[model samples]
Target: MDFGEYDNRKNRKVESGVPDVCKSEPCMMGIDEAGRGPVLGPMVYGTCYCPIAKSSLLKTIGFADSKTLTEEQRDNLFVKLDAEKANMGWLINILSPNYISNSMLKRNKYNLNSLSHDTAIGLISRVLELGINLTEVYVDTVGDFNSYQAKLKSIFPNIDIVVSKKADSIYPIVSAASICAKVARDKAIKNWKFIEGDLFHQFDYGSGYPGDPKTKQFLSENIDPIFGFPQFVRFGWSTASSILDTKALPVKWSSKKAIENSIKTPVISNFFGVQKQETVKEKSHKFFSERCLKSVKNLF
Candidate 1:
């Protein structure tokens, strides 16, 4: 929860100790994401799993909608979650903003949906590899509900995959995951350290949503003109990209492939393949050169 070195761009994971239920009996897991809509901070993927027979215990902890709960309320729920560590397990994957921007902006263009899918798949795969007896997976839908459901089923044919509209609110395990994700995201943003410079030591950038007035003002006031916004912002986002296009100086970058292709090659370079090019010589070798009497093998 400390989220030390918040400015680091690396992706990271946090998890609870393996629950006894998961290893001993068939389990059901839920997957949910947080911070997907925010213009700032890392997007988080969280998963929770427990014995199918005992999953109802999660509901008793009042793990409903995390968005409706106060910060203190959510924190209390998270504490309760740890108390149930013997019966259930939770894991989180934090995707840094810079990483999100770079992945979306790269030449091949990894879209957000694909990123989300991969993250969920990876978390489940990791849990299975750890020898958990996961029998079912419930997920809040991404993109098309059925398509997403099918994709997950293909990857985990042996598991019952349920991709629904709002799994977090409907399922106890997913609600647990929702709380874990929200708590981690809140802690991350509250502790975010700007690695850019001292200028942002105490500046308040509220909410980190594109529509938030404070966040908008903070972004507008801090534009670098030459470098655009700091690395804390997702440059690939349209909210930031528009500012760069209109306010920040235009930066046209030559791609690595373009730069490599632009280098001039010598006109004769092709002639020096595996063998060196030899100069023209007398037709009859050294004897013809001395006598100027070239012997023609066949005169047409």
Candidate 2:
């Protein structure tokens, strides 16, 4: 696999096989994602493309829903795809935990669903932009299946898109994408490196899921004075929220109501109430008027 950063450093893109899909006949591709539930590591979006007719080649290699396969099985399947690079190509988008947290915490408010949609769309758009003659796209849905399908259809009106439940299990190409995503996420978790002077290691955090006792314990114990946990943890998650609220310095928030209440406003009398008028002072006599100037000239 070739590893590199996307134009934006927020995410990394990995690709395998340098097939010229444009020159060859049209092909079908699949898109799927992994690690959406984990609070640690990156959420990876994976895409696999191959000649539609050669899809049987994928089935022969035992590609299936990655969740059903053991870690070793997934690793072996990746090796198979690597060996058959000439026939199949795959790509992945690694959305780091830092990236995910920052995006979620932005003032504009980017949710996970939108992030996932954009990431998947980006990968598919990238493949097509690379001049690949992609015909059909199959994807597993994270939310409303129909809504996601509609979104893809609007983007690729010329191509066919199938968004369904468990597409990774139903479609061979999707299963291949699942393998790529799952393997990439697992590798990221396994190779996680903490920065210098950090007291905690990746193992101390377990799988980085909120339900994991180790992960919860790590978040509970590692609350920083200002920054919370290291970059490995998602500070925007509820787990971090609870810890910061309870253990770290108390965070005070100014709500709209509180601000409005704090502002002072002068009371206004009723429109029918009597009004007070200012007394008009008599016009002060001008010092040395025309008559006074004449008298002064006579004296000179």
Best by TM-score: 1
What are the RMSDs of all candidates, in order? 15.1, 19.0
Residue 214 of model 1 has an lDDT of 81
lDDT, candidate 2, 211-231, per-residue tens: 999888877877676656666
Over the stretch 168-228, how does candidate 1's per-residue lDDT look in tens digits? 8998788888898999988887776666776764778888889888877777888878756
Worst 10 residues of 2 by lDDT: 290-299
List the candidate 2 regions with Cα displacement exceeding 4 Å.
Answer: 1-9, 196-198, 252-300
User: Clashing residue pairs, candidate 2?
Assistant: none
Q: Please tell me which predicted candidate would have the highest lDDT against the true structure.
A: 1
* Reference-based lDDT, each prediction: 0.83, 0.80
Tell me the lDDT of model 2 at 98.
Answer: 72
What's the lDDT of the predicted structure labeled candidate 2? 0.80
